[model samples]
Target: MAPRPPQQKVVTLTDPKAIRALAHPARQRVIDELYGGSVLTATEAARLCGLTPSAMSYHLRALEKWGIVVRDEAGEDARERPWRAAAKDLRIDHSGHGAATTAATRAFAATFVAPLVEELLAWAGSDRRGQLDGTSMSRGRMWLTTEEAKALVDQVVALMAPYEERTAADHPEGAAQFSSFWSLMRRPEGSAAD
Candidate 1:
């Protein structure tokens, strides 16, 4: 038999309605749970987000309509249906939207990212001797032309392929999932600090 096709890893959301729907705090939490490889039922998502099952069902339906998540047939039965993330990453372009979309996008990102930021800070504050080895965070700034910026993103995405392809079974002993967050952008005018 032929080799299986590679999965679509990133999905771009261009509709403002869809973006707004995804900006809900509880919905983002449900998406997070699914993205972390848990095939979750509405009840499970509800529990994770501290919402009623009916409420989570509504949010999951909205997410499903936007193609952010899909039913996992393999993990479902008559009693319950499970949902999984449609892709490994979701992208929203904020270039041309008005204040509302920008605000919604910011709300979505802030709610989604706050936990990760807290996690990093906790890791940083822990005693080095008792903390996990080989974990790190780095920051830098550089000026580049628009074309060069696009090329840099392309290169990094290519580098991520191998790590993205691995399954839980492929993970080595003592290995755990690591979250890598990156931000690249032009400095705003009148910025004083580098």
Candidate 2:
């Protein structure tokens, strides 16, 4: 068979309505499931998410309406339609709106973070401690100038570029899913030192 087409990378949110559509949890779950190059039917997705088939179908439709996912016509079965994510990265520009925008952005961030938290917890609980053993983990407060802060963010983004490019390939079989979560928050000027 011919190779599958490369997945599209999210550039910008041209439509605010699409962003709003993805604000729902169930729809976000659908997006996450289809992220790692998985083409799944609504029934299959529902079973994975522990939801009724009809309910999962509804969310899948919402995702399709938002241009976040597309249906695969190659699948022969009409009863089970395969779906894939529309983009590899979800880009949301928060420079426009006020309070509502902030809330929406937070909701979007939470949608992605929740799954990672669960996965990390599961890994910690597993008997195979070797995976996490000898791992280097660090958490601390840092004080940096405005320019320095921007440089730090750029460095982190550059570090993750290679891994992001790998998932774009057609990996049909089971493979390890790795994710790196980076968060940076700076205090206002004159804030108390730690």
Candidate 3:
């Protein structure tokens, strides 16, 4: 049978609390697993993250409280229910929300990018270039009006959103999960943070 199309959707987070809650690394591990279409029990997630099952269960409950993950039906065992990612994507849009929201969004962005950065560091320190073939680093500089930047970003997101939601089973043979990170910033007069 042919692979199915992605069930593309995004849950946009504006609540500062939710954004902060999701900044936890353990929770992100669960999100990544679920994003790859693996419905997991807390124990399974714990195993994947090298945490105790009880600790993992606590993290799962926290995510469930925020509606970031939902419980699926029990499989063969009546006691172990699986969890699924609430949506294909979880996005942060705290702009214009004030200081707390801004801080939470900053933390979320850092948390989201940290693991990918570690992967880059790993590649840099390793000699597994052949094993990691097709991995790449890209850089580009562009000058565009604010409106044009927003439009371009929206277009890119729209184009990739569907692909981002594809499940492990939806991929071809020998497929692996690929991590990606991108940032767009304008050149600032004095501040490099821009």
Q: Rate the local accuracy (lDDT) of all candidates.
A: 0.75, 0.69, 0.78
lDDT of 3 by residue, 1-194 (tens): 22222244777777898888888788888888886667888899999999999999999888878778787767788798878877777676656568888888788878888788889888888887557477888887787998999999889888877667667667677867777676676666775544
Q: After superposition, how far is residue 20 of candidate 1 from its true place, in Å?
A: 2.6
TM-scores of all candidate predictions against the true structure: 0.80, 0.70, 0.82
Q: Is candidate 2 or candidate 3 better by TM-score?
A: 3
Model 2 C-alpha lDDT per residue in residues 1-194, reported as the tens digit of each score: 22243357763564556566676667767776676556778888898888999999998998888677878765657767678777766566656666666666666767767876886787678886566544444567897887998899779867866665555344346655655556677765687874
* lDDT tens digits, residue span 1-194, model 1: 11122246877787777777876778877876676556778998999999999999999999989888887764425578777778776677767568777877777677767767777787768786366566777788887989999899889878976676554545578877776676677788889774
User: Which predicted model would earn the best TM-score?
Assistant: 3
Model 1 worst lDDT run, 10 consecutive residues: 1-10
Candidate 2 Cα misplacement greater than 4 A, ranges: 1-3, 14-17, 130-137, 140-162, 165-175, 184-194
The pairs that clash in candidate 3 are none
lDDT of 1: 0.75
Total clashes in model 1, counting residue pairs 3 or more apart in sequence or in different chains: 0
Question: 92 in model 1: Cα distance from truth in Å?
Answer: 1.3
> Which regions of candidate 1 are displaced past 4 Å?
1-7, 74-76, 125-132
Per-residue error at 33 for model 3, in Å?
1.7
